[model samples]
Target: MSINPTESCLDCGTPLELTIAGQKKKPCPKCGAYRRKREYQ
Candidate 1:
């Protein structure tokens, strides 16, 4: 299954974008990191 690099967050509905690391990141740069962390755990 392929992923959309420009999609929104499934949980918070925040728009997403590609990061320098090639990961889909949240629209809110600050909350993005926290959200990803919470998602993994």
Candidate 2:
């Protein structure tokens, strides 16, 4: 399959590396860390 283009992270504006994983609603590292921090608060 062709490598698909990645989308931007909604929270952090980082380019989501979805090229390898395909279209998944995964957050970027910074957003993930921020979300985790918020969840524990």
Candidate 3:
């Protein structure tokens, strides 16, 4: 099974529901700017 994680945008703090098999990062919906994913170590 795959574990999907929740990530937030660094600039806008928007909640991102990400899939494990999806891209490492995506653009913020609010700002339309690219945002990095928060690492869960």
Candidate 4:
């Protein structure tokens, strides 16, 4: 099986493969790390 690194948590390095529940925007399940917005070109 292949794991997507982008789906991992940034803070505690936990797996964040699941999407936020109903757009509630919950924190990481393992480390409780919140998601941050990023800017791209």
Candidate 5:
């Protein structure tokens, strides 16, 4: 099987890397430090 190409971080907009483990919802690495999305506003 192959991972879907649509997988990505909603915050930083980075392409999410995948493995045999599984897909999980994780904070964006580029914006992981900031918990709030509205912080930039």
Candidate 6:
């Protein structure tokens, strides 16, 4: 399956591009803190 090419931060809801596979978390460029993927609901 293919993951979404981009995801938003769970905390700040900031959208980030997925550069690597299996990445669960990423540092928010705006907040400067780590954020996890939000559930698809």
Candidate 3 TM-score over all chains jointly: 0.50
Name model 2 segments beyond 4 Å from true.
1-4, 19-25, 33-41
Clashing pairs in 2: none
Runs with alpha carbons beyond 4 Å of true place in candidate 6: 1-5, 22-26, 38-41
Q: Between the candidate structures 2 and 6, which one is better when assessed by lDDT?
A: 6
- For every model in order, what is the number of clashing pairs? 0, 0, 0, 0, 0, 0
Q: Give the TM-score of candidate 2.
A: 0.38
What lDDT score is found at residue 34 in candidate 6? 75
Q: Write the per-residue lDDT of candidate 1 for residues 1-41, one digit (tens) a residue.
A: 65435544555656555355765443554354334312211
Residue pairs in collision within model 1 = none
Model 2's alpha-carbon lDDT is 0.46
lDDT for 28 in candidate 4 is 85
For residues 1-41, write the lDDT of model 3, one tens digit per residue: 66545677778888776645655555788987676466563
Best candidate, TM-score = 6
Off by over 4 Å in 1: 1-5, 18-41
> Residue-wise lDDT of candidate 2 within 1-41, one digit each (tens)?
56545456556666544434354444567657222112111
* C-alpha lDDT of candidate 5 relative to the true structure: 0.46
Error of 5 at 4 (Å): 3.0
TM-score of each: 0.30, 0.38, 0.50, 0.44, 0.34, 0.51
Clashing pairs in 4: none
lDDT of 4 by residue, 1-41 (tens): 65533455668766565555487666888878886433222
Ranking by TM-score: 6, 3, 4, 2, 5, 1
lDDT of 3 at 26: 57
Query: Which is better, 2 or 4, measured by TM-score?
Result: 4
